[model samples]
Target: MIKKLFLLVILCSLQVAVAQELSCTVIVNSDQVNQTNKQIFKTLEKSLNDYVNQTKWTNRTFSVKERIECSMMITINKYENSAFSGTIQVQSNRPVFNSTYQSPVFNYQDKRFTFNYVEFAPLYFNPNVFESNLTSVITYYVYIILGIDADTFVKEGGTPYFKQAQNIVNLSQGSGYAGWQQTDGNRTRWELVDNLLSNTFKEYRLALYNYHRLGLDNLVDNASLAKQSIAGSMKLFDKLNNVRPNSFVLQAFFDAKSEEIANVFSDGPKVDIVKLKETLNEIAPLYSDTWSRIKY
Candidate 1:
């Protein structure tokens, strides 16, 4: 019985060690701040790195290799007393099946991030409650990453995670924070989550699932069929754009996928080139230059 108990404890410890969902790198840049003591930024970077990497954000157990790959770059624009104002660039990616390539899932820059932090202080976050702005913002993006990664694997699988992010935005309302309100900007946290969860943009989410799983994942097995599927998925964006012209979600999708779409079709059949160019230009005229590189 003692031997069995010892083995059980070992298994539990192993599970705990491998359960975190994100493998994220956090950078704190304070070059814009004219401060002599820059050690605080270094401490902030390490603290955020530990907070994101070590914290378990989901119930699903993940092996070290399966953790979601993501990054956050915080550029401290100004420092006054204990308050810091900065912009955060957040990005996350997923590995394409049967390939060494990774696809960008989310890439956004939040310019209104302002927070208060003390050197060496622990960063704390609770999904149900609004805590410090620093932790809340980090946690919000973490769920967004998880949601987008899951949606690529399963249809609308990101709904719960997006809802979790919405809850963070809801709890943060009236906190006087810059990015939590609908009026903050077109690309505010509230608007992003709202569009993801709304039925009006359901096609956008479905297109993401088809684009990644049905399309990209099958390239190694059948390039022609995969390209066809990816082009079909791109058509869904036209539907989304028609419903809401130039929406933030539509722009965000193209922002992450423009170059990828070009590279994927850079050497495809003549039929695919015609179809892709027509559909892509119709939906994303902003990427005409990038798409022009695709050869028939």
Candidate 2:
């Protein structure tokens, strides 16, 4: 009996050890001319870190710890033609637990552009509606990083961050009538624009947060809600595509989501309970993989 007990304890210990966590960072590089916008990148970095660490999961599901392997740097690069770009480099130790391990290294470089607040300003100034408007931004970008459409994420029942975002958006709706903005700091205030400018890039900031918080913790439970959020995110991507047909980010989202959806159908039809369960497990990895590639 004692030997059996010892074996059980050992097995438990192994399970705990298998559930390790990972950490990484982003570095943005640009020219001195772009230095003024550096803070935006920095803020985004901090937000990503926060999402990966604190967001709680539902039903005591997967929980990720933020064990920083090293400091992350964002560099700004400039060209003679008056062009500027941003590059992000992430370094981290892999998290291994229960035969599950992830060592994700993401590197991508792209031109830097700013999203004007005027396009969405009317909703931004309202305290109640702010989160939803913010959700719109993040939802749009998370799919872009994943090579999926904002509509896709919403359709898949997007992460918890979507609900939180909706709360903000709902709160902001009627509050703008009184010219009552400035509930937050200056940078946030400025992000709340309403005009012809596109919000495609701004979505990345929100996507990172949603991925970190929701992906790590598994805070969402109701599958229906999750699907709606994912669909909403996909719709935002569609909107971006309408404005900029062949944008790099939009293309990426389309490719990723299309692959993911295709993969779900590739395994064959689900005709029985056993087959359905098997298919569900197989499709689960697609969700994780899609979210993992997201730039935040």
Highest lDDT model number: 1
Q: After superposition, how far is residue 222 of candidate 1 from its true place, in Å?
A: 0.6
- Residue-level lDDT of model 2, residues 123-188, one tens digit each, is 222323343333233322222222211222232233342344334433544433211134533213
> Looking at candidate 1, what is the lDDT of residue 279?
83
State every prediction's TM-score relative to the real structure: 0.93, 0.28
TM-score of 2: 0.28
What's model 2's lDDT at 147? 22
**Residue 125 lDDT, candidate 2, scale 0-100:** 27
C-alpha lDDT of candidate 2 relative to the true structure: 0.34
lDDT of 1 by residue, 1-296 (tens): 99999999999879757769988999999999999999999999999999999987878888767788899999999998879999999999999999888899888898889999999889998767777999999999999899989999999999999999999999998789899999887789899899999999998899999999999999889888888878888889888888898888888888888999898887754345777798888889999999889887
Candidates' C-alpha lDDT: 0.89, 0.34
